[model samples]
Target: MAKTAKKIGSSAERLLKVTEALCAEHGLESVSMRDIAKAAGVSPSVIYHHYESRIDLLMAVFRQRFGMLLALRAPLVAELEAQAVPDVDKFLYSIMAPIAFMRSKGEDGAMASRFIARALMSSLPEIKAEVDAGIRGMRETVDIAQRAFPHLSREEICWRLHFTFGVEHMTHWDNERLEIMSDGLCNARSVEESITRAVAFAKAAFLAP
Candidate 1:
């Protein structure tokens, strides 16, 4: 019994480490339980003992990242409600505020942002459901839209959200391309510029008749 329990504990730690490494090297979709087990130096069955399926494991991966983002967004809630700053642009800045901060936090945080951006772009239903559940304000913006722009319908409101999201996802790019494209040329390297462009474009597009 003692030996078996020790083995289980060891397997759990390995699984966690493997999960982190996978996130760092590749996003959630590219990993497999067998790959995780090999990275952890444990047998493949060990992962099954802990997770029912690979999707569950991937959920665990993005769940942690989602949690991190949510926590980062929490503080802005009060400001959001206060309407301290006029217009939806402030709200957009608040929502993306945390993600921009991740830029200076080194590779792990940066990669998390990239991985998350990629996941949202994919066609996987699991990913879509998880994102819907994870990013509450993503859809909550509908309320703001309705209140701010009564001329728009429920369907039009949804379109604005999609447009906003599409602009955000456009930031996900190849680092190689970025370096080549912007080495000496003008490009928005700072997070502030990217956010400004996205927020401005979204507001203009949504507010336009």
Candidate 2:
């Protein structure tokens, strides 16, 4: 029985991996269960056995990736909360570091990052609601941000955080646009540098008058 359960779990994980890659390479809306099955070397029926529908599978993928990110950020966030006063830079870095770590993971990591980006723009209402709910649950970090900038209205803080998300999303593209714009003087590829610059940028934005 344990072996059977293990086999089932492995098959589901393989389908998720194949689906993530396909969704990242193509767009989430373009990838079908048949595509996933073909890529995973399984049949459509097999996918159905594991997932009720394409949306269900996509949600599973989102949950898996988002859960990983939250797990990585939890300790960082806790440490910040333990501080007498939250450092703005450290507060932002706690949020950004997990994402940077994921992006540094090579092909699989890149695929996860792209899929996450795509998920954020997913048109399906269910997917959007799930993503929104997950983001809402991470309000602890936002609370830290609120403490770091008591002068900023909660609404303004949220807007700046939204912009911060945009910056973080752009980094996943790895296009080196910054390098081109700066005539190769600026590189956006270093994870530490990216996080530092993003933290500084966000700090300024948060503290803007």
Best by TM-score: 2
lDDT of each: 0.68, 0.83
Q: Looking at candidate 1, what is the lDDT of residue 115?
A: 63
| Per-candidate RMSD, Å | 4.0, 1.7
lDDT of 1 by residue, 1-209 (tens): 99999987777656665676675567666777788877877677778898788777767767777788777876665566666333676766665567766643687777677666666654567978887675575555566566656788989888777777666656434333555787846355567666787678877887889
Rate residue 122 of model 1 by lDDT: 46
* Predicted candidate 2 versus true structure: per-residue lDDT over 1-209, tens digit per residue: 99999999999999999999998888788998888988999889999999999999988998999888788888889888998779878888886778888888997887888888788888888889998898898677678878888887888888888898777776646537887887888768788888888778877777778
TM-score of each: 0.74, 0.92
Which residue pairs clash in candidate 1? none
Off by over 4 Å in 1: 1-14, 20-27, 45-50, 84-86, 122-125, 135-137, 172-184
Report the Cα lDDT for residue 117, model 2.
79
